[model samples]
Target chain A: MSSTRSGGRSAIVRARVLAAASDLVTTKGPQNVTIPEIAQRAGVAASSLYRRWGDVGALLLEMAAERLAQKFPLPDEGSIEGDLRCWTEKIVLGLNSTEEPIFFRILLAAGDVAPEKRIKALAPRREQLQAMLERGRARGERTPTVEDLVDHLLAPLYMRALVGLPVNEALAKHLVERLLNTPP
Target chain B: MSSTRSGGRSAIVRARVLAAASDLVTTKGPQNVTIPEIAQRAGVAASSLYRRWGDVGALLLEMAAERLAQKFPLPDEGSIEGDLRCWTEKIVLGLNSTEEPIFFRILLAAGDVAPEKRIKALAPRREQLQAMLERGRARGERTPTVEDLVDHLLAPLYMRALVGLPVNEALAKHLVERLLNTPP
Candidate 1:
């Protein structure tokens, strides 16, 4: 019972800290936000933050995963191309959004970290995409490997995002067309 | 004449620094090596290291680009599938090697400080892949967008690399087949 209570409290603290960090990221660019500031803003102790997250990268990775989950959702459009386009548009929009660029930037920054963090941060996104692909396959889309589909459809967005270049709807449409028209 | 000499000197210094850094990364893990240490090994002043490379991430990015360029000439394999398999297998071998994982980890870390650096670092590899795709297309193998083909074929290698997982030759073959079979 004591352990359960402690776990609950820890979960609550984590949520609060995540919320505060999200706001800071939105308000200031990700590079500007620091852990102590996040703790102060969240009304949590610095030691608690460190203890829960293990390090700033760990904390930022969690925050990015949470934010990305909320920002990009897989809408079941009932058609393969439609679903892909929807997903593609959502990702491109997230990358291109003026407000969320910092979040995207931070996520990419984290991805650019050491292999361990890059993989940990990427695993959640990859799994979610694979799940979406499975749904599409169930609906008879003739999708390729979940890994291939995700990489093909999303890599361009990541490429453009990291390049800090304009990615308009036209580019998104081109990517969708390429993915859809690609022969399996 | 003076301008040419200065440019040559700059290139030579850059090459030496990158070479020294690669030697260190091969011998020591990414997290264990330092910029000053790299400078000491390269026989350049520590201040020169900072002025030229800015930080370890900057140097790592250069080293990654240089090392990556060396890993592939791909081959005249006669078919896109064959070429891709061969190309990807080489990369898989590199990733599986004991030393290269740490090298990639450092490259990922560099991506954090400069997101643009990620694209720059990956540009040569992307171009080489793109060139191969173009050659395949010219040889009458139907390929979708060259960019998508490259990403689809290579992203998993990268995903696996970042994830700290082994990418076996069978997996590389599978990825290549999926990519070759997929039409954009």
Candidate 2:
């Protein structure tokens, strides 16, 4: 095969491996998933898997980063409350999505075990939220401090996710309302 | 041994075993801990460990319940803000406690995988908070619903614990202030 074709094949292999790993993490808890099992599921050779990702943890971290990026698109609803509602509702929906909770729990556990990796994985997502907040502030909306955002907005969402609490649209709306209405 | 002495000895053994299990969970991530290792650390026979708890999950569940009970003692300082500040400061301290994060992550992961166990472990702790809120309500404080309490108070605390974020007195006080000031 030509060099270009080989490059395309390699990309396909990586995608398949990541997809298989994500599926395994969803079905079986991250603690239960093994590299061999992932390789088998991906129909990729073990050597190829190792060459690409080094280990299951690395692969899982990458998968988590990818998943997070996909899950949180920067919301632009023109007003702070509208944007927050749109963003938070998406978060609640993502949390409530079937199989997403398991995947999220695994990623969280991974973060707990590895702080540096956690920072790296979350930096981009945090930046996205930060930029969105800055935009709202520029628009003369009462944007909360980052600390407040984490405590009032993100933390509550995460806590519900971890505790298996229902994350409905109403809950999302209430959160935004409280945050926007509460005085600093 | 006499029957009374045997009962006393069994209780001691249970305590030792649990202590050792807690230590192991703190030192080694919960996934790395084994029953035999815990038994060895506790200076008990492997059979006794298995006979008492059956498996690691059961032991961890018991440990989580025990830890939760100890960490959150209901605070009644004559006013809602005082009580919340007192209670939340303790929670922040517990979250910032070295090794506590790992233990909490394990329990949270267990909760995610098994919802029934999560309810069993958290029910008493939730009740304590509920009772505290009801007392404040009787004192004419604007007590939030149980659902709101989870969203506004507990969720932020748990999120910080799981994510290795700083759970400080300032943060706790801020949380209480926001909760009290925000209209339900």
Scored by lDDT, the top model is 2
Q: Please provide, for model 2 over B1-184, each residue's C-alpha lDDT reduced to its tens digit, 9 standing for 90 to 100.
A: 6999999988898888889988888778777888899989999899877786666766776776677677656888988788888877877776766644554666664643455445555666668878888898899877777777677877788776544466678877877787777777
Cα lDDT listed for each candidate: 0.68, 0.73
Report the interface RMSD that candidate 2 achieves against the true structure, in angstroms.
3.0
The TM-score measured for candidate 2 stands at 0.68
Give a tens-digit lDDT track for model 1, residues B8-121: 998998888888888888788665678999989888998988886677876777687767677646566887777777777877877767654554566545534455555666
Residue-level lDDT tens digits of model 2 in A44-80: 8888777766667767766766777676577888887
Clashing pairs in 1: A112-B108, A182-B183, A182-B184, A183-B183
True-structure lDDT of candidate 1: 0.68
Docking model 1 quality class: incorrect
Off by over 4 Å in 2: A1-29, A32-63, A70-72, A111-117, B1-29, B32-63, B70-72, B111-117
lDDT for each residue of candidate 1 in A18-46, tens digit (9 for 90 to 100): 89988887787666677899999999898
Give the distance in Å from residue A53's predicted Cα in candidate 2 to where it truly belongs. 12
Error of 2 at B159 (Å): 2.0
